[model samples]
Target chain A: MELFHLVLRNLLARPVRSFLTLLGVVIATTSMVLFLSFGEGLRRSLAQELSRVGPAIQIVPEGMEGLGFSGYPEITPEEYRRAVAAGKDLGVKRITPTLFLVRGGFDPQTSFFFQGLPEGVAPDLLYPGIKPQAGRLLPSEEGAIVGAKVAKRSQLALGNPLRLSPRVELRVEGILEESGGLADNLIFVPLKPLQEVLGTENYTALLVALNPGQKAEEVARALEARLPGLKAQTTGDVMRFAERALRISDLVRFGISLVALVVGGLLVANTVMMSVYERTREFGVMRALGAKRGFIFRLVVLEALLLASFGGLLGLALGSAVSQAINLYTLGQVGLALSAVTFRLSLFALLVALGLGLSAGLLPAYHASRIPVVEALGRV
Target chain B: MMGAVRAENLGKRYRQGEKEVVALEGFTFAFPQGSTAVVGPSGSGKTTLLNLLAGFDLPTEGGVYLGEVALHRLSEDERAEVRLRHMGFVFQQWNLIPTLTAWENVAFPLFLAGLPPRARKERALDLLEKVGVLERAHHLPSRLSGGEQQRVALARALALDPPILFADEPTGNLDAESREQVASLLFHAGQERILVLVTHDLELAARAERILYLKGGRLVRQEVPGPSR
Candidate 1:
């Protein structure tokens, strides 16, 4: 206890030196924490966006290319049945058959035709639910769902009826929940109706769900073997390709975060070095008084920890406030966007901050510990 | 029997370029359990001898026995342990730690020895009272006068209640009256320890149990007093 007060008093005696050193440590730790937090957030966002795509296995027709966006595949009903039977043989579950088309607009005003989904196969049932803005989604064969933003722009409302052709009429059921994602521009209808409009009684693709712990690759290989000329792709494989694209975006964000952490380390190192110099005499005295080399090492490191912990606590509070402010501004005040950028201090960021603090002090503290006691005493 | 220091042919040397300057050459002495002074002119190796006795410097040859242990054979840490448990030092310059208050400085050795806070405070206060500098206990060394700082240094040297006290120059930096006061305090401070002082002041040395005058790093004169000078 007596020694504790003595060490504390020695540091406190030179408040300016101590405070400046502490400030440096804090800046470094804060930057490290913020960067790590950003990386974590980006990783989560990327994963979330990837999962937004439909199930792993998208069993398209033989030699059917450019299934996404081009919106057409020439698979017969017999081919779709064959693929479903092959997937069933491979023990795949929930094989949702979908009829895809790229015909002209369901409305004469738009050039884009709605994508078609199988009966009882809800687009909402895809990996990420296609949430509806207002009314419930389409029931079996009665109504149609439109992306909320598209519906709003098109001035369409629930219960409104639309005529795609002289022969087909469908009631607007619901506006899909805006996923600032790809689902935002989509239109969905019953698979049978869409297949009929495309002049076919067969689906262009089949989406399958696997049992937990079953490898998608194994299932897809089995399905491919069971049905010749049919291509079987898992949700993971599709998501992987999309994830690669997302990784590029994430890498840029992560790079910025990495730079921030390095800046933080430099800040801490500079401050702690200055602190060690200022406490030279005090350290010398401790060494002279029979304090072992390790004691001085611990003391200097403790100083760094103290400074970093203070900064980390402050940064956490500040980060939380910043996140809350963003939430308020984007969600409430401005109300111009679908979602606001939120700040989250994940456990990973907290641990990274702790690591930064510890490492930042290590070299400087070691140097402080090794300073010759005699030279320090003479100088003082 | 209870002598504070016992030495047998203690020697120390330093090398400057190719010249080996002998600081102390096989000097044999004992400081009995009472006050004693070493009076010698400047560059007489008074400080070096004090350093050797205080366990701050190692002997190149021969040995210094503080109480029962041979200090020359001990490791640096072992030497520090010996100093903490059995010895106290009052440097000629009164090298007080600048950051600590007078009382904190006085209690430094006790803290080093891991004494509890309350006990350290009580003992430091008690010693300050004996040294008559209790009122200046809270003042830092820089705030205290030279005499006061020396007195506090003296009080600190005695805090562990060591059996031996080593003062390189107890009154070398003080004014006449303050020197006399510090000298008197150094001699009469209530303790059953031996006090060894290095001084160039002959009158001050005359007050010790014995005065050894050093010339050319050798003790050339040994003066025994019949009464206090």
Candidate 2:
């Protein structure tokens, strides 16, 4: 314990150098935690959003498996009718066609996804747990329902007119309660009116709800088999596709974390090496005062451990703050929740910092232990 | 009775590039309990002989004994153990650890010896009082003057109350007045222990019970200033 105090005092003796080294560790550890936790948050958000949409299969034009809600080859009216018929034959209870369009937001450059459902389909039947918070659901071809986030962002209220284009406008019939998923950010209108606005005669995809005790995969396979030009995919297949699309993001996160760790380790090594060099003579004096090599080794390594532990704590705080700021900034438009700083992640960060400290301290501590008493004493 | 230190034909050699430079060779001596000074000129291997006697260095071809323990035959750790248990040392430049306060520096050996914190603190303060630096106990070595630092070093060397003490030019860096005061304290402190002084100060050398003169790594003469202690 006394030796530990001595080591601490040694670090305090060179305040500037120690502070700079600590700052380096803080920067590296903060970046590591931020990148990894953001990636984890994004992954969890994706899974939650997918799970909330329920275990329904989707029928889209052929080769549109992973293109989620955007830029898909539209299904012709005849194709849509045949796909709905095939779904009914495969034990599907409900088949609703939806047209997806991207329209400019209140701001010209920014855009949001607009989903169009059939005028008679109940919103609760399509989006479970979602209900009208105000007014009513879309009641006519010229009416619209704004999601919670869209209403909050665009300040659209019930009975207000929303302009889809220069010549197309719809009155806001209802506002949705927060659903805690992608539906929160969407704008919903009747299918025929959205098709007219998009200048298309076909739907983007069909949402098929399976009958009781009928498996989604079995029904999807049957629908695809019967409708030769359409593709049917279960919820699990969609999730896998989403995960594959995120592989590049995973690689980028891994790369950032790796770089942060290496930089942190190297910074620790450089700091410890410089400290050892500066204290060569003092170490010799300890040797002459009867300190063994093991004693010297422990003293130096203890300094590094303290530095890493403190730096890691600072990094965790900084990283968590940065994550909260990101969450506030993105506001879920990117479908990312950046507030996933779990206890497990905090523990992992501490362990990594400790391991790096020990690894980086090894060479310098060994060199300090091996310093020759006479030669070191001779140094000025 | 066994002498405090015994050396049998102790020799030390160094390799300066390709040549083997002999620092000390064919040296033999037995030092009893009291103050003895080894006076020599530069390059006369005074520090080398002191290092060999204190178990800080191994003799190239011979051995030294601290009482019954053969110093040269032991491993480095064992030799350090011996130094910690039975010997104390003061160097030429008052080499106190710069990061430590005066009291903390004095307590270091006690810390290495695994003494409890309260006991280490008590002993260190007592030693500082003995050396007349108790008031400056909280000052770091950098804050203290050369003389004060040496006093702290002296107090630290005496912390364990070892049976043998070695001083290698302890007053070499002090002013004349401080040197007189330090030399007096050193001689008085040696009354109960085996204090060996390596120096070229004639006046300090004359105060010892015996003085050995050396040149070319050889002891040329031994003079008894007065009756042996």
Candidate 3:
């Protein structure tokens, strides 16, 4: 017990050095936690948005890749109507086809994904209801449901007529709630007018709702077999892609955190080595008083453990605080919030930090124990 | 009476660079237990002789027996165990752990012995009171004056009540007054335990049971103090 106290006192002798080393570990750990959290939050947000629509499959025409960015696809009216007809024949409950505009279809404008729902259907029936800041949406052929972002950016109001390219005009019927999703920038329109403006009689992509007892996979296979030169996708495909992307993103984040942890471990090792070197005479004194080599080994290792454990705890607290603050800010601004931004104690990260600290103590402890007792006492 | 320390043709040599330097060669001595001092100027092998008897350094040739144990034959670890379990040492620097309090320093041997905390602390306090440093028990070695540190060291040497205590110039760094105080404490402890002291101070040597004078790594003279009985 006295020896332990002596070891602690020796470490605490140079207050500034010990504190600075601990602070270094804290900062490094905090950065690692924050970096991983940001990646997790983004991935989660993407997944949430994709899962909102009730398992609808979207089919975009080939060579119309930019339509996803700014709803403009080069599909002839015949092909669009054919795809919709094929979707209807596959026992689908509904086939809603629409046009999408990109970059708000004008210069210095944001892009929106505009899906045209069938007339007389409740707008909320097919998609999640929009929390309107100003007006309600009418379920009519001429009525339009505008994304909250588009309303805010274009400064359009309810009952206002907004003109699109090729002489298509839309009446704003309702505004949506801020969902922090792809829909935030989207503007819905009537299918006929949108197709007329693009000089097409067909939809750019078909949104298929399968009949009851019909799985999405079965319906997708049916639609693909029926339509030539057209592809069918289910919600599961999009989900799988999203999952793969998230896994890759997580791997990258994990790699970065690992590098930082290794660097922190090296810093700990260097600090312990320097401390042992500086306290050679002190170790000698203990050894001359009949302290065994194992005693010196444990003392130095314990000192390292003390320093690193202190740093680990401080880092965890700081990182958790920063992550929670970010989560709060995100919830306030984006409506969707992250539950945890840092590695929760539920994870194994805290244990990993302790293991790293112990590993760093190995070489320095060995060196301390091997110092000759005779040489130490000679100085005495 | 049996000698507290007996060396038989003890020889110690070290490889310095390319040549073997004999620190002590073919030396033999035995003195009655109590307070015996070995006095010599620097390089007279005073410390070398002490190291051999304390079972710290191995003799290159020949042997030393401390309390019937052939110390030179023990392994390094065994020697260290013997030191912890049976011997106590004091040094010129007073060699107190700078961070520990006076009482804690006195308790160090018991800690090495793995004694229970309560027993160790009790023994430490008792030894501190015997050394007349109980008031300074909680003060660190750095906080104490040189004389106080040496007194604490004396208490530490008596912590385990070892039969033999070896000190190399216990008061070498103290002023005259502090030196007297430290030497008196050490000599007082010798009444019950054998105290083998190595020093260059002839005045301090005169108070011992017998004094052995060394020159050029060899014992050149022997003197019995107190009018030679």
Candidate 4:
């Protein structure tokens, strides 16, 4: 018989203990995979959305310069004018002044991300490839174009009136075709109505698109130098900042997952140690029958590795299944696939499991190999 | 030095709470190449002598030699290697690995000796057949009767054709009829090899060409049992 078969038979001799140990590893791996997948998913989604944005640079209030800037618009009309005038001298495209407002609750029906641009600015000029799925873009200041996800969630169609306040209401002129990007969750309207609603004379940011042959980096540098109080951020700058933030969060997530890995490792150690202790007498018999100490050590350690391997594979399968289910739910809720199980993560989980097996097995295997033959044989 | 087994001033001591107990002391013997039985009552160092001579335990003050290699001076790992290459053992408890089938138990020594699977199986089957347990080769140790397990163990000890064999109360767990059957096979396996038996049965000891009586951790007498088989 092969040595592998011998180790297998030993583990199979008592099925309950092995299964319980396996279950502990599975739970640990599942939780780890599930938690880390969020970081992977957020990175992927942000990259996709960042690539789709039309503007090359955004000049905003200094602190509010990255993706998903949601604070009240603090940049005044004067600051926006200064940024636009400075960009006009450069090889720049049209500078669009936009205001952003968030009015909502946790419920999808009540939640709204409102982007207010100047009257008659074509939606495609600001968000490329945007077109009406149900109706046309805003034809007048009295009308609005709702994004695909928002429209579907609110069950709105063309000509349905959306209320921003008790006094400000506009007819839904169109519903945008789904692009599965950030714009899919916004409601686009004319700037005048939203400013009147906010009761403030301020602009959120000045969106700067560059003409052909103008590098955004140089233009953004010029814009920042021209306007000292305000900050000009390029798309690449925003993406890098977001990625850094995600990386820090990733570290925190992995630190939490490590807790589970440690517990799983302890379970493996306990199970293998008990097996070594209970089977010492058999080990002595084996030694008497001419089996070497190295062979006995390998037997015990191999058992641990087998258990860990099975647990890691099963955990990966289950974690992937769960991530797919989560993506399905998040896709329906926000038009975003928010959980990912990348190939690298699967490899990492398996390596961690094998590492756990080796570390857990060493002490027990040593004890088993060191046991005196006489004392072991002396046991009944 | 070759083919000769000898002990020189062999002694062993154990610590029990603040006192020392002598398990075996001042043992000297040149075991012949055939069969020899060491017999004594309980707590008379029968098993202790077997342990020292088999190199399973170290003697405190003396040494044992298999040819030129000193068993007592060798490290535990080295002693284990020697046992694997040259010594075969049968314990009183019929210590067949409970997880292995009858044939697998018999094949274990061959497997340890690095024999290929087919060759190990062939030799193990031949030995099992010789011991009259061939039909039960696939049954696990727990599923077999006590007599059958001991027979498989005997088959295992002879698997590698070792030059030295140690049987520690091999028939201690068997009934009278099964004892006779195991004793017959064991003696047949002893021919031309150094076979050492530690037993309490004088009847079984009579089958050996020589017997040494042990008492109070010392060898008291040696006699020629006169071939009664």
Q: In angstroms, how far off is A132's CA in candidate 4?
A: 1.4
Candidate 3 residue pairs in backbone clash: A70-A101, A70-A102, A71-A100, A71-A101, A71-A102, A103-A111, A131-A177
Clashing pairs in model 4?
none
lDDT of 1 by residue, A1-380 (tens): 34445446666877886676556545554454444444344445445555676666777655553234454556566776776677665667767776655545555235434667766666777636677787776544857887765576677888887676667777888878766654565667887666656566766677777767777789888887877777777656655655565567556755676666566666667767876787677666555555556777777677666656666666665655554454455333212222222345445455556677789889998898777655655521
Best by DockQ: 4
On lDDT, the leading prediction is 4
Indicate the worst ten consecutive residues by lDDT in candidate 4 chain A. A62-71
DockQ (C-alpha) of model 4? 0.67
Q: Mind giving the per-residue lDDT tens digits that candidate 2 earns over A1-380?
A: 38778888988999998998899889888888888787667667777877777438888878886534777437888887887677666788888888888877555226666788887875666678887899886557888888888887778898899787788888989889988777777778888777777788888888888889998888888888998888888778877887776677767875878788788888888999999998988888888888999999998898888888889899988998998888876665543575566687788888888888888898899999998777778821
Per-residue lDDT over A127-177 for candidate 4, one digit per residue giving the tens place of the 0 to 100 score: 888788888876478888889999898898899997889999989998999
Candidates ranked by lDDT, best first?
4, 2, 3, 1
Cα lDDT for residue A194, candidate 3: 66
Interface RMSD of 2: 2.4
- Model 4: per-residue lDDT, tens digit, B11-120? 89989999999998999999988889999999889888889888888899788998898988888878887887788888889988989999999999889889899999
Candidate 1 residue lDDT tens string, B113-198: 88988999999999998888999989889999999989998888888887788776778889998898888888875235788888
**Off by more than 4 A, model 2:** A56-67, A73-95, A105-109, A155-171, A194-248, A257-265, A332-336, B1-3, B227-229
RMSD of 3: 4.7
